[model samples]
Target chain A: MRFEVKNASFSYKNDRKIFEDVNFSVDSGDIVAILGPNGAGKTTLLKCILGILKLESGEALLDGKDVRRMQERELFKRVSYVPQAKNTTAAYTVRDTVLIGLAAELSVFKSPGEAEEERVRKVLKELNIEHLIDKKCNKISGGELQMVLIARALISEPEVLILDEPESNLDFRNQLIVLDTLTKLSKRGIACIFNTHYPSHALQRANKAIILSEGHTVCGDCESTITAEAIEKAFNVKATINEYSDGGNTIKTVVPISVIR
Target chain B: MVEKKSIKILRTVLLIILPIATAIIALMIGRIAISPKDVFLILTGQGDMVETVSRMTVISFRLPRIILALFVGAGLSVAGCAFQGLFANPLATPDTLGVASGASFGAAVAILLGFNAIPVQISSFIFGILAVVLTVLCGRGKGKGMTMIILSGIMIGSLFSALISFVKYVADAESQLPAITYWLMGSLASTDYKSLIVGVPPILIGILILFILRWRMNLLPLTEDEIKSSGTNVLALRAATVLAATAITAASVSMCGQVGWIGLLVPHMVRMRLGSNFKTVVPASISIGAVFLIIVDTVARSLTASEIPISILTAIIGAPFFIYLMRRGGSFR
Candidate 1:
C-alpha cells in the first residue's frame, strides 16, 4: 500500500500560510519521518494527512482514493494512527484500550469478545508489554503508555501506521524501544510515517524524510534531505552531521553547536 | 479489570436480584402496613387472605410508585453516567444538558395553563428536548465542542429556570402556585397507572438505547481528535448520548418533578466500585439506581404520615454517605 499527501496546505486564522503544496509518499516496507522546527507545522502537516484538520487545498490519498472521502471503517482498515502520549491517558486497563482499535470492525451495539481479546493480547505481546494488560493506563510509566498506544494502532492490522512524536517524552532506552519497534514493523511491509523534532532520528531510522525549513521544504531520501544546511535553516541553529562506525555498521549523528540570530 | 466468569455471573445475579427483593419489601411496608404473606398472595393473584383496602393499597397505590421508582432511578442514573463520560468530567450530572430544568419549566407552564397529568408530561418532554436542541444550536462555534456544549447548557439551564420563576410569578397563588411549588419539590405521590402508561415509555426507550450502545460509550471520555483516529463516528456517538440522556432526564422529571442526587450519585458509586468501563457501569447504574431510588421512595412515604418529597430526602441521605465513600475509597479518577 502507498500513503500519499499531495499539494497539502493549511493556515491558522489570520496567520500566514503555514505550509503550502507539501507533498510526500511512503510505500510498503518504508520508514518515513516528518522533521521540522517548532511552529514549522510539522504536527499540522501530520494532522492534515491524517484528516484531523481539513487541508485548505490538496488531499491525502491511500491507493489513489481521497482519505477524507472514505468512510472510517474502510479507511482505517488500511491506515491507523498513534497520537502523542500526553494526549491519550484515558483511565482504561491496557487490554481494553487496545481493544478500542477494533471499533470500526464492531457494530455500535457489539462488545469485544474472546476473539478480540486474543488479538489485543497478541499485539501487546509483540510489543513486549503484555504484562501491563491489566494495569490502568494512568498508572503506567510514560514509556509503557506509548507502547500501549502503539499496540492499539497495530491491532487493526493496518498497512499504514502514522505516529505523532512517538518518543518525544521518553528516556533514552525507551526511545530506542520505540524506534526499534518502528524499524521492525517496517520490515514487515508496514509503512511507518512519524513526525519528530530530532533530525538525527530521521537519518538514523527513516529511509525517506520531509524537512520543513524556514521557507523551503525538502522531501526525499533521508541522507540528502536532512543535510547540515537543512537542519540549520529549519531550526535556526548551527549544526554538523558526524558519522561513526562499529565493525560493519555506520551510525550518523547530528550535533547542534549554537543558536543562529 | 477482567473478572472470572463465575464471579461475573455472581455479580450480575446479585444486581438483578437486589432490585426485585427491595421492590417487594417496599410494596409490603407502605402507608397501610401489610404482611409479607399477604403481599406475596396479592402478587401471585391468590388474594383470598387479603382485605380489599389492603389489596387496593398494595395493587393500586404502591405498585405504580415502585415501578416508577425503578424506571426514574435507572433513567436518571444512566443519564448521569452518560453525561459524565461525554463531558469527560466526574462532576458532570444528568442536569448538565438542562433537561431537568427544561422539563420543570415546561411543567410550570402547563400547570399555569390548568393542565394536569398527561398534558403536563407531554409539555415537559417536548420542552426538555427543545432546550437541548437550542443549546446545541447556540454552542456551534470554532473551539472545542464539549466546552461550548457545557457553556451553552449552563446558559440554557439558567434560561429555563428564569422562565419557571416567571410562570410562578404569574400563577394564581391560591391553587396554581402551591401545586407548582409542590410539583417542583418532586414526589412519587401523584404517580398512578394512567401517568405511568403515558410517562414510562420514553424513559424505558432511552434506557434501552443506552444499554444497547453501552460498549461504544467508553469512547465518550476520549478527546474529539482522539476518537476520530478510532474510525468510529464521534458525532453520532455524541448525538446519541445527548439525545438519550436528555430523553431519560426529561421523561423522569416530567413523571415526578425533579428528583435530584440519584443521577449524580449512583453512577459515581458504581464507578467507585467497577472502574470506568461502561459495559459494567451502564448495567450497574441501571440496577443499582433502581434499588437506591426504591429505598429512598419507601423511606419517604413510610417515615412520615404526610409524604415527603424525594428530592429533599436524596440529598439528606446521599451527601453524607457519598462523602464517606469518597474519603474511604482511593482516587475516583
Candidate 2:
C-alpha cells in the first residue's frame, strides 16, 4: 500500500500554522523519517497522516482512498499508530495491553477467542517480550515498554505503521533497539513512518528523510538531500557535514574554536 | 504458586460468603430480633410461626425492606461502578452526573404540584433522564476531555439542586417543605413490592448491559486517537455506554429518593479489593453493595423507634471510610 499526503496544511486555533502544503508519500517496505527541530510540526504532520487532525487543505490518500472518507475501523486495520509515550492509568498487564489491539478483529459483544490469544502470544514472542506477558506495563523498563507498545501496534498486522518519536524517551541502547526493530519491521514489507530528533538514526535506517521547517517540508529525499545547508536553514544552527570513514555522513553543529576561549 | 492460587480461591470464596453472611445477619438481627431457627423456618415455608407475629413481621415489613435494601444497594453501587468507568474517574457517581439531583428535583416538582399516584414516579423518571441528557449534552466535547464532562455534571446538578431549593421555598410550608426535606435526605422507608417491582427491572437490565460491555469498558479511559487506532469507535461506544449507565442510575434514583454512599463507596470498596477490571468490579460492587445497603437499612429501621433516613446512616458510616480511603490512595487506579 502507498500513503500519499497531498499538499496538506493545518493551523491551530491560536493561529499557529503547524503544516502548510506538506506533501509526502511512502510505499510498502519504505522507512521514511520525518526530521525536524522542536515546534517544526513533526507531530502535527503525523497526526494529519493518521487523520487524527484534519487538514486545512488537501488530503491524505491511502491506496487511492481518501483517509477522511474511510471508516475509522477500516483505516485502523490498514494503519497502526504508536504514540511517543503513554501513562498507564490502569494496571494492565503486557498481554492485556497487546490484546486490546485485537479489538477490531473481535465482535463487539464477544471476547477474544483462542485464535486472538494465539495471535497476541505470537506477537509477544516476535517482539521478544514474552517474559513480560504477565508483568504490569507501568512497572516495566522503558525499552520493554516500547517493545510491548510496538507489539501492540503489530498485533493488528497493519500495512502501515506510524510511530511518533519511538526513540524519544529511550536511552542509547533502547534507542538502537527501537530503531533496529523499525528496520526489521520495514524489512517485513511494512511501510514505517516515524519522527526523530537524531538525524544519524534516520540516516542509518531511513531510505528517505523529510525535513520540516515552520510547517512546510523544506527537504524531502534520501540522506544526500538533507545537507548541512538545509540543516542550518531549518534549525538556524551552523553545522558541518563530515563524511565518516565508513561511508556514512554526520551533521555536527559547529562552534568556532575562538568560542572555546 | 499453589499457595498463591489457594489464596486467590480463598479470597473469591470469602468475597461470596461474606456478603451472604452479612445479609443473613441483617435479616436475623433486625428490630424484631427473629431467631436463626425462626428465620430458617420463615425462609423454608414449614413454620408454626406463620399464624403468629413472626409471619407479619418477617413477611410483610422486614422482608420487603430488607429485599429493597439489597436491590437498591446493589443497583446504586452497580450504577456507580458504571459511572466511574464511564467517566474514567474514581470520584464519579450517579450524583456526579446529576441523576440523583434530577430525580430529587423531579420528585420535588411532583410533590409541589400535587401530582399524586403513579404520575409522580413517571415525572421523577422523566426529570432524572432529562438531567442526565442535559449534562451530557452540555459537557459533550469536540476536543475537550473528561474535565468538561465532570464540570457539566456539576453545573447541571447544582442547577437542578438550586431549582429544587426554589421549589421548596415556594412550596406550602405545612405540607410540602418537610416532605421535600425528608426526601432530600433519602429513605427506603416507603418501599413496597410495587416500587421494588418497578425499580428492579431497569437496575437488573442496566447492570446486565454493563456486564455485557464490561470488558470493553477498559477502552473508556483511552484517548480518542488511541481508541480509534486500536479499532474501536470511541464516540459510538462512549455515547451508548454513557446513556445506558445514566438511564440505569436515573431509574434507580427515581425509585428510591437519593440513597447516597452506596453508589459512591461501594464501587471504590470493590475496586480496592478486586482489580479495576469492570468484569469483576461490577459484579463485586453489586454483591457488596447489596449486602452493605441491607445491613445499613436494617440498622436504620432497628436503631430507633422511628426510622432514620438510610442516607444519614450511610453518610455517617461511609463519609469517614471514604475519607480514609482517599487519604490512603485507595481510589487511585
Estimate every model's Cα lDDT from 0 to 1.
0.86, 0.77
- Stretches of candidate 2 off by over 4 Å are A13-16, A86-88, A113-118, A215-220, A243-261, B1-25, B35-49, B96-98, B116-159, B325-333
Candidate 2 clashes: the total is: 0
Give the per-residue Cα lDDT of candidate 1 at B263: 74
lDDT of 1 by residue, B1-333 (tens): 356877888999999999999999999887688999999999999987789999989888899999999999999999988887877756456565677889889878987998877788778878987987776678777774435666787789899999998999999999888888887898998889988988899899999999998988988887676688788888899988888888788778877888987877899889879887888999999999999999999999999888889899987866676556445542323
By lDDT, the best candidate is 1
What fraction of the reference interface contacts is present in each model, in order?
A: 0.60, 0.46
Q: Tell me how much of the true interface, by contacts, candidate 2 captures.
A: 0.46
Query: Which candidate number maximizes DockQ?
Result: 1
Model 1 whole-model lDDT (C-alpha atoms) = 0.86
Q: Candidate 2: lDDT of B296?
A: 82
